[model samples]
Target: MSEKRPVFPEFDPDEVSSNPSDNRSFGDVVATRLSRRAALAGGTAAAAAFVMAGGSAQAAPRRGPAAGEEPAAAPAAESGRHGLLGFRQVETHDRDELVVPEGYRVQVLIPWGTPIQPDGPRWLKDASNSAADQEQQVGMHHDGMHYFPLGRGHRGGDRHGKGNERGLLVLNHEYIDQQILFPDGDEEMTGEKVDKALAAQGVSIVEVARGKDGQWRRVKSRYARKVHGNTPVTFSGPVTEKHPALQAGNRPMGTLNNCSMGVTPWGTYLACEENFNSYFGTEDPDWEPDTLQKRYGVDNVGFGYNWHTASERWDVAANPGEVNRFGWITEIDPKDPRQTPVKRTALGRFKREGCMVTEARGRFVGYSGDDQDGDYVYKFVGDRPWREHRRAGRSPLDHGRLHVARYNDDGSGDWLPLVHGEGELTTENGWKDQADVLIRTREAADAVGATRMDRPEWLAVNPKNKDVYVSLTNGSGWDSAATPRDPNPYGHIVRWREKGGDNTATSFHWDIFVLAGDPAYDEEVKLGDNLFGSPDGLWFDADGRLWIQTDVSNSSQNLPEKGYDNIGNNAMLAADPRTREIRRFLVGPRGAEITGVITTPDQRTMFVNVQHPGEATEAWGEPTPQNPRDVSNWPDFDPEGRPRSATLVITREDGGRIGA
Candidate 1:
């Protein structure tokens, strides 16, 4: 469903710009290919590495040396690699491996097979983990993560570590590789693989403390928890009580595909669920015109892996009616591991890729990306101002107005209302009404006319400028010759400054911050346009340095030979937003995507996740004889040797703050 431009609230394009080429600050002509097939194809290419991991795990050689064989190094301190710039790029590769500047060390905090629950089953190479046991262990495909200092606040007896303030590392288990994550493939997934897979797809909260030698270890604390498919969720907001699809005769269920996360102003964590719609396969799977089904991508019975064939199918195990629960932004209070997660249904559900908060007029404004081809961008305006009190009793998310954006042909834009009981969304237009608007929001946005964009993925707010930046993934409609307009072809990064210094305002001035792509592509693609292409995850460090991570997995054509061909794997770059200058900082291993970045408050430690390495191969048992040429045995198997999808710690050799 697409949103139509509403007549009530009028916007002036001329006031936003004067010259055609310079009218809109965003580069509309710098287009990327956008197609349903393209999106799926991209997933297939990226998912291949994970498939191989499964195949090799089952048939490969035995496990090697036990844990802790490597000696612990001194706590991170000043070293030559740390230099004046402060950050030194240590490891770089297209294959899956962890990298750190010299003088800094890297270690695996937790492995995919680690036992998290008291009774969680030990993971075996042949794929024998059970659903019930998995509920107690850590999930798979770890992505965005954040570390929080605990003990300073929390309930009684639950005070974590003492003087040192032992902390919690919250990770997002993005998705599962049915092949490697399981024993054989879906063919061998059996009862255990399905259950474990579901259990591994949510959030993993583990306690971490600096060991006796200054290394970090997962501390055995009551605060450690896992929220997955079976975990209960609370539905609160406009659509909670009335939306036809989500009503469930009661409330929503769990969260799936928790790709990226956000830290709220009040200190709670916001986990965004992406690709939730793909899990919902209906009873009458043949129903083509189903409204709820169409809006949420639930038309097919089984698109690839027939998860329904398994015992604990979320769509069927807890009432097919309950699948409506997965897409919204769910908030988790790390301090209290036992409390239920809240699905802020007010923020219309789609494939929520990223969620972020910025202070505006004292109130907190939440920004998010729907992560679908041509989907709209959204922001939530909280009713109350954010208080600095970090005590354990408050949650600032209760009330807010959710608005969808309409980017104009010119640089400026307006926020269209997706509120209940307002404008054409009422019960008058043969519609099921406002509740429907909140549940099947894409449809409601279409009825109102919000501008369709290239796949909207990650969002970043520049701490120095208060300007918002969004990574627009690759699009098919972005062809420069096909569209004539400077539509984002290879996808670009867009930015906007709130009007009159108010983020909660209904309108704002905007521009194309960086037209992501090869400078050799086209002069028009150049946007006076700063440099870059296919921008993905974005974050601003404490020192006002903006880190731009590229999602160029599909556009390898743009990269030059020599240093790039053998070493490039969707890198994380740093840019001075003030000067629009960007430099590549870190790269990922083969078949792996770099994600989930964070730096310690003092900037001494930088943590990052290398996801799904050595992706393109078949089952572990099938000998290389059949599929003669496939990349397998990732991170650890590389001729260079390493493990797939592991979190790494990066620190400056000189021991100053990162990016100095």
Candidate 2:
């Protein structure tokens, strides 16, 4: 009876158990029963040499194609195809919708309560709208996006002009389920349902265009805004003057759980504030907590979005600095919807999951990822260099030089420098300066030793070889006394290059570009046509073609006794990193989660994002009348409705581009 544990042992509610035949949310039966108890305590040739060098060969990727060959034909569409060239890889689907490929099409454009301003509020089928009509509509789960473009003039578009054909999408509304946004689910969590779930959590922007029949719609413009969770925003760098709970005249309100985003090459829009400590709670006792709130698992049982009964700044003992103004990196300026969103804070808050940026030799680097489970890997750079004009109101993420990575078991790494008086970041290692080394950036990267990883989330880069990648997305409680390596439990993709290929290089070299699981669990490092697992959203595009989404675990799709049944759903592969192939492009819709991809710089549109579909059955909350179904209605399954969370688009029916 002595094995109870879990008071949030870093959340293992049976791994996101809203239950769906519970395969222990991505732990695939606790990593196949800890690989059969480490092959009976270190035998079976030491657990097959630690699962083939924990996913073979310093994590494969010295150029593609080899793991089961076949990748070769992709040079046609006007002799300029990109990524996984000549395309033609698409077979896994538990189908509820979206599949893509064969000339591509997809559609859907917007979903989660779409309205796009102009006095919003009109999406109902029981979403009962109104937190002022979801702060004038369109917000809820549609994670990470970007598109800016407008009249082909500027703002990350105009690959050949008129192609982006008008934009300003922006996205990221990350959370809110309340049994699909209330109608009395869990008795509608109170008061205008927590003010329409805090106006359906942050960031939206809208404004899409294209139609003369070419598709892409959502137009209403006035820079169609949304930025919820109470919107005010401000803070800029050095934890807004050394965190006394982030000072600078106290501005920091909105932006929540935004997840995977980053645009700026002098165009703004970064979002990312993942899992905002699950919308905080813990009633005041004079709050205290610390150790960066227990290494960011922050408890007091909150993700129930009780929102401290509708605000006491959602409690943390009544505003213990509003969870330090939500894990930083906010930014937004999708062509100014009356500008305001700032955060930035020298880019160093954990739980961040996205932020890519890139400019290299002229500074402006970026690249984050601290999405839990043994966290680490970060970047930043930019003290000043990226001048394509923006001095009339500065903000290259306010000022940088963050760092953090470490790796080194030889394949090389090293970045460190979270600089607070440097070296052991000290006041004898208490780090009391650069905003306490950027608000205790994971205890100053575990006081300079770094390298914990195995759940880092996005970070793409590689516009034709700037090389950066990183996804890692699956970790499930390892530490049966350390030493397992490579981002254990079915998840990989590391990549690196830095140094001379400078992104302000502190040092680099890294490897491991694909070791996701179940191609019969590593037949020499899987992938012979996409046998994916975990690898959460990494992008690339503009003709570099890396893509790769995943997130698998709708009870391990198609469930082959919970072991990644030959990669059946939750997909969107694409790779090519110079012929290290990896195909299967697009395959979600059964329990969703094929998160945000993005394209259109005339790569002929693309988009992606699926997130939480039929979230493991049990027909979501509320909706009675003899169980009026609501778990997987999806894009319009409407068995009484409720399973939104969309944003697709795709294109190429004959227009070209898009993984041609």
**What is every candidate's alpha-carbon RMSD to the true fold?**
14.2, 24.1
Sliding window of 10 residues with minimal summed lDDT for model 2: 17-26
Query: How does residue 643 of candidate 1 score in lDDT?
Result: 34
Q: Could you tell me the lDDT of residue 121 within candidate 1?
A: 68
Per-model TM values vs. the true structure: 0.76, 0.33
Error of 1 at 193 (Å): 2.8
Candidate 1: TM-score? 0.76
lDDT of 2 by residue, 186-297 (tens): 5535667777887887888888777778788887787887888778877776666345765423356788878788887768888888777777786556566666776666
Best by lDDT: 2
Candidate 1 worst ten-residue window by lDDT: 9-18
lDDT to native, each model: 0.58, 0.67
lDDT of 1 at 278: 55
Off by over 4 Å in 1: 1-93, 100-104, 117-126, 151-165, 241-244, 247-252, 282-285, 301-303, 311-320, 386-395, 430-433, 478-489, 520-533, 554-567, 617-634, 638-643
